[model samples]
Target chain A: MDGDHACCEGALAAGCRFVAGYPITPSTAVVERFARRIPRVGGVFIQMEDELASSIAIQGAVWAGKKAMTVTSGPGYSLMMEHIGLAVMTECPCVFVNVQRGGPSTGLPTLPGQADMMQARWGSHGDYEIIALCPDSPQECFDFMIDAFNLSEQYRVPVMFMMDECIGHMIEKVTIPEADKIDVTPRNYTKLPPDQYLPFKPAENMVPEMVKAGDGYRIHVTGLTHDYRGYPVMSADCQEELVHRLVNKINRNEEKIRHIIATDIEDADVVVIAYGITARVAVDAIALARKQGVKVGLLRLVVVWPFPEAVIRDLANKGKALVMAEMNYGQIYYEVERCAQGKVPVLLAGHGGGDVHKTEAIAEKIVEANKCLS
Target chain B: MSRTEIKIGGFGGQGVILTGFIIGKAASIFDMKNATMTQAFGPEARGSACSSQVIVSEDKIRYPYVKRPNVMVMMSQEAFNKFSPQIDPHGIMLIEEELVDPAGLPDTVTVYSIPATRIAEELGKKIVLNMVMTGFFTAVSRIISREAARKAVADSVPPGSENLNLNAFEKGYEWGLKQLEG
Candidate 1:
């Protein structure tokens, strides 16, 4: 199966019962599989008018007590930004899949790009955090998609499943474990009676329990800052309380949410930092560099958001140089450079999209970065 | 082989991508090797030139695309012209004899030509040309086992048309074997 089809299977396995999306290049296969499979699996797959409707409709389904998601690419991701902020402010638990392609606007519809890494973090306006996972292979697409849903339900944040065209379109063997073997996180519904129930009240984890639109619970879901009672609170104090908790819930639990795959980094002079398709391509480059006697290691970001700052900082403290390779002009490079904090030389091996980084080019960059150590 | 990169190229509606899929499926699922397949996207795939790149490896496949294909299967003149220059110096080139004119290829490159479309037509459906080509690829390249390729053909084709497709594959495989012996 391809990554897109594996993603659909993952969604089904994770109890995703509703999907609303507009067909777009590269990402269309995800919803296409969902549409065909959901009929027998007892779910709803709706092709909404555009990205905006698709983004918000999934939120409505989430409120109706269904695990839901929406899929899109670069342009459509741009369109869904406003609603992404809404999903954050209302604390809706849903997955947003961005099968990234080239573009500031309608760029390469059929090619791969990692330019949306920054957008996945800050595409939506305001001071809120969301979980994002980058899967490099078809197998991880299935495994991480389930994690994306579980993370969304765990923190009540809109989890972003960030995939590039290469991973989404590439076909590979994917082993799906038996349903009994797979662990699924059920939504945390409040047990309090209708009168006693407060939808926005936080548990010790700072993540509030959820309630659907019905069930006789009085709830007010709003984009504006709200109190524990779920009513709109206009003061800066309420904003401080609500927004601070929203950001803190993720920031405080960063260690639990971060997923990094490090290889041969203990005595390395140069480290290659990459996510999504770039990480897969960098594997070959790192091998080539190693043959030329450069101690280049790889730090593949499986969980790209929350930045994995501590790991990068730890590496910068010891490693001689870091190479950030991505399909864009350099989105995550700034983040890596920031975390390095002048401790080492940080370089960018950035492309303008359309295709993946050349293995030779990346190898050359690694060799150059290693020279700086000497 | 540690890594074998194969490119199946032709115009769209010719099952170019499906051919690559079956090959990858054979290697990964039946043969127990790792295979990754990616195709060229966009309008050119409608009826114009297009290609599917498949990498079969005993080890894990890291880089997905085929930079220099160890095997090139061209079903159209455009695909032949477009991709033949990038073939590995010691690679094997397979082509549809009736459709492509193998003019400028290097002498060192071993070229196997088959009238796959004609063979498929004799099998009662010209659309099965890709299957015939796939069978020929299995026999000549020897990368995927015959049993594995046959199982993949059956597993991939539409349910009702399995017999015809399998027949097409067998015909191509037999023809390829004859070519090798002679």
Candidate 2:
């Protein structure tokens, strides 16, 4: 299976019963599969008029008590930004899948890009946090999409599934386990009676339990600043309280949400930090660099957001030079540089989104990064 | 082979991508190897020259694209012109005799040509030409087992057309074997 199709299967396996999306290149296959597969499985797949409608419709379905998601590529993702902020503000636990293509504005719809790495975190205009997962292969695409929905349900935040076009279109063997073996996280529905339930009230984990509309619960879901009773409370204190919990729920649980795969970093002179398709390409470059006697290691970010700060910090403290390789011209590179805190040199082997980086280019960067050690 | 890179190219609607998929599936699913397939996308893929790259390996595939293909399959003259230069010098080349002219290819490459379209037409469906080429590829390259390729053809073709497709594959495979013997 290809990554896009695998993502759709993963969503269905994770109990995602509603998908509202407008078809876009690279990402279109995800919803196309959903549209074809949902009817037999007793689910809804709506092709909305536009991305904004698609983004919000999933939230509507979520409040109707269905596990929902929306899929899009770069241009559509840009149009869906306002609703992403709305999803964050309303604490809607729905997946937002961006099968990222090259872009600032409709750039290279058929090619891959990691430029949206920062956009997935800060595309919406506000101070908020999001959990984004980047899967490198069709197998990881299947595995991480399940985790995407589960994490969204667990954190009550819109989980961004960041997949580039390379991974989305690439075909590889994906072994799907039996349905009985897959673990799906159930929605955190409140057990309290309608009278006793405060819609915005937090539980032990700082994530508020959810209740569906028409369930005899008075739920006032809005994009505006709201209070514990789900009513608008337009004040600085209310803003502080609401925003703090929205950001902190993800920030405080950073360790629990972070997923990184590190290799041979203890004694390496250069460490290559990458995610998505770039990470797979970097594997070859690392081998090439190792042959040239540069002690190079790899730190692949499986979960890109809540950026694995401590891991990079530890490597920087160990005096390891860093190389960040990505399809875009340095989106995650700055994050790596910031985390390194000037403790060591950080280099970026970046490309401008039509094709992946050459192994020789990345290998050269690895050797160059190692040169910084001497 | 520890790793074998293959490239299949043709004009759009030639079932080029599906050819790559079947080979990858045969290797990864039936032969218990690792295979990754990536194809050309966008406007060019609709009706113009397009290609699909596949990597089959005993170990996990790291890089997805084919830098230089160990095996090249060209079903159109345009594809031959575009991709032949990138073939490994000492590799295998398969061509559709009715469509492609295998000129200027290195003598080191073992070139095999078949009238795959005419053979498929004899089998009553010209659309099964890619299957014939796939069978020839399996027989000539010996990268994937004959049983695996046959099973892959059966599994991949549309329902109720499996027998016709398998017959086309067998014809092509037999032709390839005769060429090798001569």
Give the CAPRI rating of model 2.
high
Per-candidate count of clashing residue pairs (backbone under 3 Å): 0, 0
Q: lDDT tens string, model 1, A1-374? A: 99999999999999999999999998999999998998788899999999999999999999999999999999999999999999999999999999999887999999898889889999888998999999999999999999999999999999999998999999999999999999999999998898887888899899999888777787889897899888888999999999999999999999999999998888889999998889989999999999999998999999988778989899888856999999987788999999999888898999999899999989999999999878
Worst 10-residue lDDT window, candidate 1 chain B? B40-49
For residues B1-182, write the lDDT of model 2, one tens digit per residue: 58899999998888899899999999999999999999888986666678999999999899989988999999999999998999999999999998998999989998999999999999888899998999889989999999999898899989999999899889889988987887
lDDT per residue as tens, model 1, B1-182: 59999999998888999999999999999999999999888875666679999999999999989989999999999999988999998999999999999998888899998999999999889999999999999999999999999999999999999899999999999989988997
Report how closely model 2 matches the true complex, as a DockQ value. 0.92
Interface RMSD of 2: 0.4
How many residue-pair clashes does candidate 2 contain? 0
- Model 2's alpha-carbon lDDT is 0.93
On a 0 to 100 scale, what is the lDDT of residue A152 in model 2? 97
Candidate 2 per-residue lDDT over residues A54-156, each given as its tens digit: 9999999999999999999989999999999999999999999999888889999998988888889999998999999999999999999999999999999
